[model samples]
Target: MLTWIALTALLLFSLATYMAGRRRAVAVTAGKPAQLHSLPGYYGSYAALWAGVPAALLILLFAMFGGRLEAGLLRVDPPAAVQELTAPQQDVFYDDARAIARGGTPSETIYDGALKTALEDKAAKSQQISSLIQYGSIGLGAILALAGVFIAYPRISPQFRARNKVEGWVAGLFVVCSVTAILTTAGIIASLVWESWRFFQAVPVHEFLLGTEWNPQIAMRADQFAGAGAFGAVPLFVGTFLIMLIAMMVAAPIGLFSAIYLSEYASPWTRSVVKPLLEILAGVPTVVYGFFAALTVGPLFRSFFNWIGAQLAGGSFDGLAQYLMQVQNQMALVAGAVMGIMLIPFVSSLSDDIINAVPQSLRDGSLAMGATRSETVKKVVLPAALPGIMAALLLAVSRAVGETMIVTMAAGLQARMTLNPLDTVTTVTVQIVTLLTGDQEFDSPKTLSAFGLGLTLFAVTLMLNIVALRIVRKYREQYD
Candidate 1:
């Protein structure tokens, strides 16, 4: 509230300063604005910058100090009962006081009068500090604006370069944006690496990277029946790759063929109708696909497999009946197939664009040499678009690897090492979600394992992108 109020007051004062600065500039020009150094709007904007920047900095300073001030004020001397808490419990007490001061119930076991009196004192101190900061910032801005007007009014001749200064600030803003993006990426990587390092300290890196088992249940008490958590990530990666492979298998050929038809074979009206209808599949939520996979596709596949199994069971291939019966409502194939459907638009749209980008002269040349349309597409256009198509496929693979909801609903959360697409499997994303779902302690390896999984997923996706880049660059040289 204080921050917002300060900013609003600062903005209003800046507007007033802008008006005054523009009026002063015109007055300096003896009512002939054309003789002024820069445009009236530029002068006004410069004055507004002088009026707001100092005040904005002050407001930011206050916000940076506000949290520590509030926490210190609330935590000082506390109540008798809260002061008697253990170190950890005292942290909780301060948290409770902060919550209560913010209109929540007090969780500390203290007297009501003491709690009320402390909260009231905290509120009074907060108000006093906020008002002081707010008014002081506004006053500072007023002084700065007045000083700027005195200093700048005489300098408003034709030689002044207000536009250059403003453009410099604009360039600074761009630099700030670029730095912010770099910092954000660095922060994410740091957090992931830090937590993953902690997890690896508790669970061996080899065990996590190479072990096939992925049970992550940790027993809380000594008498608990759970074994030490197995942090093996192999099954997760394998399952992820299996499902991704299946998804790509289903999506690549189908999406590529669809793109080919739309780009090469389909007439204008046909392409217009079919392209959007096909792309609509991408707009459907993954959860909807999850439901479709689990409720519809899984059962259909199982039933169809069972019928096949039954037919073959009465013959020498009776051993397949047991395997076919294992096909259930949740499996990698179902999730993969649905995920493929979901990714069709990504592939089709990219491939279509890439195919369309192929030079028409190449196709014409092929046709002029007596090649058919299909042969021209296969021999000329496809090779030219191959790099782009490969990029699209890898992009789809990355999407498949990162998918969560569809795998959760259509593929069971059992990490198993098997080639059976009909069997249930789990992926890194699914386990990451499972590991972090409840009130799990961050210090526990079970909880920190999510960060580990995230790091692994990041590495895999990064490697894929690198490979795709190499392929694109390699083929680009050949074609370009």
Candidate 2:
């Protein structure tokens, strides 16, 4: 609360400095605006950035690290009661103190005797320390903001290049954002690698990659009946690709054809009306798609298959009929079909834009050469837009591969290696969710296996991106 108040005060001060700086620029120019190196707004923005950025950084820094600082200070001289407790108990003690200091309820564990006394004492001290940190940070931020104003307000003269300085600051901000993104990606890859390494220490990588069984449940004791866990990932990979293939089979032609019609054939008014209506499918929540698959599409497909099976019961196709009649609600077909519906807008919108971006001169030239509209579209437009179309398809593939809710709801969580779309199967993402759902011990292979799966999925997605990028680049060069 105090940090927010300080930030608000600093923002108002920055606005005031902006107005003052603009006026100063005009004043220094002796009422001649053209004498200034940059516009009055640039001068104002320069002063505002100076007045806000430093103090905002300080406040944000305090907000990020103040708790850790407070905890370090509190733990410098521990109570005898706190020191007597176990490591976990000591953690709980501090947690309870912090919660009590913040006027929130602590854990259910009742504190009694010296522990209770220590908790109350520590809570009071924690409150005092928190107040001190908050007040100190706000005061320092105010000082820095004032200092910034004093330093920047004097430099708003006509000869000063305020525009260049402001742009430099903007460039620095962009660099910081880029560096932050790179660092974040590095951090994620590092964590995945580390955890996967730990998992491989428990289970060999060859077995995880090549072994057929994927039972990750390990026995609690050495003598328990449940055999050692299997961590074969091939079934998961098969299921993931099977669903992705099914989804692409459904989505690719329909979405591409829709894009072609909208871009080339539809009138402007029709395009405007139908495009948004089609894109609305993109905005529909995946959970809703899952529900549609579970309640509507699954039952419909099942009944249709069952009806066909019943019709063929007395014929030569009786064996195939039995298989069709036994089909369940939860199958790869249900999840993939619904997921394809979800991806149509993504493919159509991107492909439509790409198709429209093909030069009108190409179409005109082809028409002048006696080619029909469809022939022009096929030979000229599609080839020109092929790279972008490939990119769109890759994005849709990524979306399909990463989907979990639709798969979990519509497709059963059985990691079986099968080519038939009617069979129940689970993907890598679904199993990752299942493995990490509840309270899990990270030391165990089951929990750590999630990271291994994540690493493998990341690798496969990266490879796909690389292959797609190469294809896009090859076609793009030809077209260009």
Candidate 3:
């Protein structure tokens, strides 16, 4: 409800801002030397941005960190048992506490906790104090806005330069929004890094990095070799690569070809019809794809393999054929293929844009040199757009690597050191999801291992992006 309210306010604020700024711009330059300082639309945009951007940002910050701040102000010790609860369990604690305060459940531990009691008290106090802050903030903001409007309201005054002022405000707002997003990303990375460091302290960095097997099972007794537990991230990473490879194999060709067909071959009418239809594929929830892969696709692949084995054995039962079939029902191939299909729009849309953005002059030049359409496209347009195309592919690969829902639902969660695309293999994303999903102790190795996996995945993607950028830069230099 709050979210809806905030969003609606943002939209209304934006519209009002545009109108006010546009009107002000027109009024400020009613006549004389600086006739029409800027496009009225730009002035309107400035007002809209100024009116909504800061408040929207404040709302977002409050949503993300307000609870943490409120929690901090309470100064009560977090329940040790509650601290051990899994991520989902921790959310339940918050929910139950809210419910308790609202007179829902008396039996809940959240209703009984010292921390909860303190928070409830603090929440009341904070609400009282916040009424003052909220009014002050909004009052101050409105005053500033009115002052801006009053200054810009005058008609053709010598000092009036509404356009410049409005643009400056717009530019400032843009910078602030960009900084907020960047800072949020940085904060996330910092948190992940800190947690990963803690995990590395518990498990040896060398063992985690260089060890060959990744059996995280803790030993119940002393002197058990298998119980020693291997943390070789190699297998998980290999599994990730295999899945990505399969996904790319399916997505790259399909997406790229689709892009070509849309950008070059299709009429504008056809493109209008096809583009949205393809993008609809992107909108399909990944969880749904997961089920499709797991239930429908997995079984079909298993059946096909069984039929092939039967056919290979001439419809006779053969012991040798059974030995040949080692892959599980949820083959990596099925998951990868589905994931690739999911990524088709991602790659194709990006590729299409880059291809279209390629200079017409290049194609015309190639054609003037007696090149055919395909030849011109291949030799001139593709080369010109290759950097962006590579960037798009790299982005798609990153998405494929980080994708979770499809893999969690479809891909087998088993982490094995195998290159077989037909075998059920786990991915880093699936492992992290499963590890963090349940009702377990946070301090347990099982939970913390998710952080390690996240860090590793982050590092891999970061490196891939860096390498992709470097490659794009190098390719760009060839043309320059």
So what's the TM-score on candidate 3? 0.66
lDDT of 1 by residue, 1-480 (tens): 756776787788788878876777677778888886688877777777776776577667757785676566556556675566588866765666555545667664653566556556655655555556556656665676567656655655555676676677778889999999999999999999999999888788898899878898764854443244478899999999999999998899989999999999999999999888977877888888888998999899889888888777767777787678656778888899999888888899989988987888899999999999999999999989999899878888988999999998888999999878888999999999888887777887788889999999998898888887787667667645
Residue 371, candidate 3: C-alpha displacement in angstroms: 3.1
Higher-lDDT candidate of 1 and 2:
2
lDDT per residue for candidate 2 within 422-469, as digits (tens), equals: 999999999999999877666888888999999999987887778777
TM-score of each: 0.88, 0.87, 0.66
* Best-fitting candidate, scored by lDDT: 2
Clashing pairs in 1: none
Look at candidate 3 and tell me the lDDT of residue 388: 79
Q: Rank candidates, TM-score, best first.
A: 1, 2, 3
Give me the overall lDDT of model 3: 0.73
Residue range with the least summed lDDT across 10 consecutive positions in model 3: 219-228
Error of 1 at 352 (Å): 1.2
